[model samples]
Target: MEPTGKTVVVVGATGPQGRAVTRHLLGSGWEVRALTRDPEGAPAKELASAGARMEDVASLLAAANGAYGMFSVQPTVGSPGTAPDFSAEDEVRWGINVAEAARAAGVEHFVFTSVAGVERHGSEVLPRNLVSKWA
Candidate 1:
């Protein structure tokens, strides 16, 4: 892959998938602006990221400004290290907010990661954690 040296805002930079994506992007010569809720937290410190909340579109837009691309991956329900009160609806809302901010920031490239059993088309049996993914 060619290194474009472009900026790519990574939402959820401290999570499992986000960490891998951040490392890979950096290795590929892409500038990564990692977004995390707790900029002072250990994980954010380790990743050297900026602070941004998924619930705050303005903050997310600010963090994503001047970026050429954006990657969005929200936490799963009951995932390790996630808040106990985090629900499927919260995940959906967070994803939506991130997308909205990215669009508002004029991001040209947007990549979103979704879990299994997340069918946009109606499915009789959807995973509990992904029940609201397509809703």
Candidate 2:
């Protein structure tokens, strides 16, 4: 069967999980818009070759135009071992950006891939990113 004319926007399309989602969605006959800062990068280009669109996140609203769904996974700042230069605030801000954009674009399905172990453990010991991924 052909695609049902539905489009899914994968916000971290260059990353592992995002790439997997993009590929699966494409294989399943859904249109995929792969989000990335570098459209020309190897990963984004590879996705593009497989029928996923490589688009910049400068304006998520514009990027998500007419999108039926959105899958958002914040950057490494939200991981267990946060990246050297990024803070928790940065991760949350990015997460919020994606969420607000999805809402603005009227995307019906939204998935925010969050980090682990934050709920079981106390926030004091964890990196801010892990504790407040979308806060």
Candidate 3:
């Protein structure tokens, strides 16, 4: 479908995946709302230069109106041996937070970036990992 005035709020706009998605969406003529922790930072500034509106993720709930989609991504755990640790929990929390916020904001679609491994777990550890995800 033609993007036109459709908006997509991309979480972690300052990160690699978010930046690439923002750039592509902007190029495709969709109104892109890039969520970042710091709007005045260099990465956010770069997105602004490309004609994206930068906003804080925590403050994006009500601002996501008319959004056609939401692109969710979490920060990395940052090294080996971290998967079974707290990093896994953190990722799950971030994902859930974004999903809930998107629902509250009336987003029509939510695109979550999840690990392929999560599908393999299939156990109570999923809940444990989710609890620590945002920690």
Candidate 4:
């Protein structure tokens, strides 16, 4: 694809899905700015090596400023290697923060990736990780 000359900020860009999106966007000629808590981590470094600009979550709004779009993803409760005490409320709060920041940054498009099965199974019956997405 021809270069669009557009930039997209990706939250959780070191995660599996996020990494895939970041790589695809870069391959498609869209500039990618990646947000990660651990900018020095292996996955984050890998994305940087692949041409993704890295930023910390605290500076997400600034990084997203003037960007054309944003791709957002959040970690789930009980996610392997994640914080052992992860909470659904925390996930929901993080998602809201990213969305609000994107809006404040005037992003043209906001693509939020959430868990599957929330529609099939109601929030009450779903796991905290899945229910957090519904919230």
- Index of the highest-lDDT prediction: 4
**Ranking according to TM-score, highest score first:** 4, 2, 1, 3
lDDT of each: 0.76, 0.82, 0.75, 0.88
Task: Report, for all candidates in order, the number of backbone clashes.
Answer: 0, 0, 3, 0
TM, every model: 0.78, 0.85, 0.73, 0.90
Q: Estimate, for each residue in 1-135, the C-alpha lDDT of model 3 and write its tens digit.
A: 365878899988778788898898899988888897678888899999999988876677755767889997776565222354546656667777888888988899888764465555545656543433323
Q: Each candidate's root-mean-square deviation in Å?
A: 4.2, 2.8, 5.4, 1.6
Expressed as tens digits, the lDDT of each residue in 1-135 for candidate 1 is 576768898888878888788878877878788876666668777666332222232478887788999998888777666798889888888988999888888999999987754664464576655666666
Give the distance in Å from residue 39's predicted Cα in candidate 3 to where it truly belongs.
2.1
Pairs with backbone N, CA or C atoms under 3 Å apart (clashes), candidate 3:
89-132, 89-133, 90-133
lDDT tens digits by residue: candidate 4, 16-86:
89999999999999999999878999999999998999998889789989999999988889775468888
Any idea how many clashes model 4 has?
0
Candidate 1: misplaced stretches above 4 Å?
1-3, 49-58, 117-127
**Range of the 10 consecutive residues with the lowest summed lDDT in candidate 2:** 74-83
Q: Please give the TM-score that candidate 1 achieves against the real structure.
A: 0.78
Off by over 4 Å in 3: 1-3, 79-86, 116-135
The local distance difference test score of model 3 is 0.75
Model 4 lowest lDDT segment of ten: 126-135
